[model samples]
Target: MSALDKALNYSKKVGINECEIVFIKKKTTTARITDSRIVEIKHNFDEDYGIRVIHEKKIASVRTTKPQEIEKTIDLALKSASGVRPRNFWRGLPENIASNQLSGVYDEKLHKISAKETMDIAQIMINSAENSKINTITGSLNIVSENFTIVNSNGLNVEDNATYISGIINAESEQSTIPVSGIGHVSSRTLKSFSPEQIGNEAQIMCTKSINPQKVDSGKYSIIFEPYSVGELLAFVVASNFNFKTFTEKKSCFSNNFQEEIAVNQLNLIDDPHIPEGLGTKSFDDEGIKTQKIKLIENGIFKNTFSNLFDSYKEGKYSTGNAIRIGSPMGRSSEPIPSCAPHNIKINSGDRSQEEMIKNTSNGLLVGRLWYTYAVNPIKGDFSCTARSGIRIIKDGRIIGPGKSVRIIHSLPKMLKNISEIGNDQRNVIQWASLPSITPSIKVEEITVNSI
Candidate 1:
């Protein structure tokens, strides 16, 4: 019998009410870039196991790097459970999970890629960003392939194979009047779709364009946020308000506004697990529940919230298959307990182009990237972020020149209501150790910025 089978059998023999096991086997390759060159390449393989045991309705979890220590891990978990509080609302684990193989989430080439080839890919990123105006290029390329398995006492056993590749390049220029920088990034599940060239070229373009930036005045103006900045906002400010746990506890900003119109009629936000080549694409959640597309917002109205088995059961509902054990370098982890998280938060495409949005603006700033983004007050939907680079000042329907750094303090509810346009240039975005989002340029009006 396999380790999972043996662990489960042993758990029942030990008088455990229920048990669950998660195993993760991962291979990671990373290429670090610095000083306009490939600096280092590293490869690692790891196996991790997580054991969860329930004794007398109380739950406890333990994690171990040694699979042979699973029995000991289970014992530790059971002993830990003795002093823990019981979840009387817990309905137990699901039985006999069914899932379909998702497309565009796995690639044979990435799964078997060598360290030499990874360095070659990193070199491509460096070469593409090479420019006379660019003085430095720094970034990282990460490729990961992982096997994830879950087994529970309720006869649920399932496994999946997934691969991911992501690259980013930051180009800095000293040739400019003031030192300026730009960034480029792309992520994919397939090798064929990954674009190192685009990453470098974009960084170079942004850096070169940001020469001699003009100062931004402290005033209210329209702002067009690019995909990367939008993703940052989504990850740090907006995504959590839709969490079922947050909503039920009245901690969400929109807790009392459910089923009400929250944004403009043109907006639609969805948690989609089935998008092609999406980094978060998967057939099942970490808890062995089948995944599905959920519309968090539709036609300007709040629609639904996502949850895992534990959160859903607490509210007398079923799981929405949003449980995730986020791993480092990019994939699922062998966490004994999973948390509620979206698979892929996506803003459905709109018909307007970014160029059109820029042209229509009377006075605005085109923000390409954001830094130090966070929620100042999550319950009030207040957020703050700094526009550091790739900022262009627009006047009279034209981009006159690059702009200097500015700090924005805004309300999320107000921003949503003031959205003027949504761009069609959707791109996949994943922040380091953060959420994965698919977004485009989102234009909002009457936002105030303080010169920094």
Candidate 2:
């Protein structure tokens, strides 16, 4: 019998009321580059199982990699469940099992990529930076192939295959007395969608432009946030405010603003799990619930929130198929308990081009990336972040010169309402395993930038 079958049968023998087992096998290959050369190449293969047992509305979980020890793990879970209070709002696992497929989620080329191929890609990126006169280049290339299977006693059996390729390139120019760095990154589900040369070139350009910096007075000014910067802000400050659990508990910024205009009329956001080449694309969630496209914000109005089974049960609502095993800084793990998270956050493109937004700005700061961003007061939508690199000052509808690092303290809802222009150059971005977003450059008026 298969491992899943064995686990389920053993659960039945133990007289468990309900059981679910998630089996995941993954292969990862990584190449690291430093000083414009390949520094290390590593490969890893991992397999793990996460088991959940429910007895009389009491739920317990266990995770292990050893197949022979699954029974012991299950027993331990049962023991744990016996000591815990029953969940009053516990709802049964999903019962419907259907066949579904997502396009561009699995690619044979990415799964079959070898160490040499990854090294070659790294070399190409390094060469591109070097060609642009960058003094140093550091980056990493990661390729992953994962097999996920979910089986539960409620007649749910599902399996999926997925592949991911991601790369980041950072360039530094030694010509300057103070070191300045630029970063470029690409994340995709297919191999052909990545462009190492483009990543390298963009980093090189940013590094070159940031050779010498000027300081600006601390004041409110127009700010143009590039896609990557917007992604960082969304990941750290805005994303969690839409959680159903948090909203229902009155802990989110949007708790009292549902169905209200929280942003400008041009702003629309969607959580889509079926976008082609999206890094988070999947047919179903971790709980074996079918995934669907959800409109979180429509024409500036807060529309809907995402939820997992537990949260849905608590709210007396159906699952939105947003159950996700929280991943680490590197990527997704198979051992963690499921929670609600967005799949691929797509911000609808606007009519204005990036060039037009820049040309029309009379006075503003152009930010290519943001770092060390976090919510200072999530309930109040207040946040702080640093413009670490690729910051340029715009004057009279033209870029004057690069600017020094600055800190921004702002409010999320107010900033969303202050959006004056949005660019059409939308790009896919993944920030430290936190958020997978497709966004475009945006210009927000009267943001507070402080000199530090």
Candidate 3:
């Protein structure tokens, strides 16, 4: 029997009303440059099993890296499901989907780059940054390739995989600092698209700006966010809501606001895993179901959520191909629970130069970078963050000095509605040391800041 067939037979033999098995295998090689020196060269292999069992329409899940422990894990899941109450909302899986290719999501060179090549790239960043305006450089380059298989009793057998390579570099100075980073997205199928030097230079510029920062008074002011910062804002607005399981269970802030538009009418958020050469691209979710590019928000209206097979079954809806079985610390729960979550995310582009956005602000803060951000509530859009790599924008179009760290406390809707302009510079921000999100600079009318 195939992997899916074995999984299904195991479920039936074990008296499981329904069951699904997800298998994931991954390999990664990483290179990091520190102070013009290659500091780290590492490679890792990962594999895991995610199993779900249903009883009385209730669901319980667990993942195990040890094959020996899977039976016990399944027992725990079955017991958990049996103890819980069932709901009609436990819809069945979607019908069989024909196989389709969502290629161009991985790159081979990123994974196979020689140690010499990787270290040389890092050396370039350190040398260039130290030479360019007072700046310090820190960066990492990661090449990852993964494959996943989904098998279930319901004749659902799906398999897909992709490759991704990404890097991040930062240049900071005590004098004037503006955080800037470079990013690119392509599949192992596409090599000409990857550029490591480009990423290095972007970081160098932001770090050099740290020379002489202008200290401005703290207060509510108009603001513009750079690409990574923009991605941060969008992740808070877009990803939180799609976390349906978290929201519905009250584990997330977006749990309460189920019926509302949470962004400006001009804002559109999407998860485009199907985009050619985009990171986090996949053909099927953890459930072996075909994946899709879900438009989470359109014209500021809240659309559907991203859910895994179990969540889809629980909510009586279709799967969003958002399930990630395992990888990273949070991708798998601290406990043995199934690891399912969103992967690729893309925001529709907006057109306007950074200079134009600054000019549009009249008088406000030019936010260069954001740090120390956490969501007070994902559903409600409550956030607090610090500002760096910033400057004060006067009535004229010229740039000034640094702005103080301010607290951005507001719901997603109000915050996005305050957008006065958007930048023409769009950034691909994966491997941001967090979730991958693509974003551009955005201007907001006012943001509240408090002094230390």
TM-score of each: 0.99, 0.98, 0.83
Stronger candidate by TM-score (1 vs 3): 1
lDDT of 2 by residue, 75-97 (tens): 98989999989988888999857
Query: Which pairs in model 2 have colliding backbones?
Result: none
Cα-based lDDT at residue 333, candidate 2: 62
Model 3: per-residue Cα lDDT over 1-452, one tens digit each: 45445556667888887777777677766777665556898878788777877677887878788766666777888988877788667666545667676657655665466767766755655555564454346667666666666666677776665666666666555443433332222122344666665666655565554445555666677777777777666555446656778767776554554546766777777877666665555676555566777777777776756777667667666666676654541122112234455565666768888777766665677665666677776656677776644444445555665444455565555676787676767656643545566666777876776543
| Cα deviation of 291, candidate 1, in Å | 0.8
lDDT of each: 0.93, 0.87, 0.62
- Which candidate has the top score in lDDT? 1
Off by over 4 Å in 2: 131-133, 327-332
Q: Return the lDDT, model 2, position 421.
A: 93
Question: Over 4 Å off in model 1, which ranges?
Answer: none
Q: RMSD in angstroms, all models? A: 0.8, 1.3, 4.1
Model 3: how large is the Cα RMSD against the reference?
4.1
Which residue segments of model 3 deviate by more than 4 Å?
1-8, 56-58, 66-89, 93-95, 132-135, 174-191, 242-263, 312-315, 329-343, 377-380, 390-395, 431-433
Q: Is candidate 1 or candidate 2 better by lDDT?
A: 1
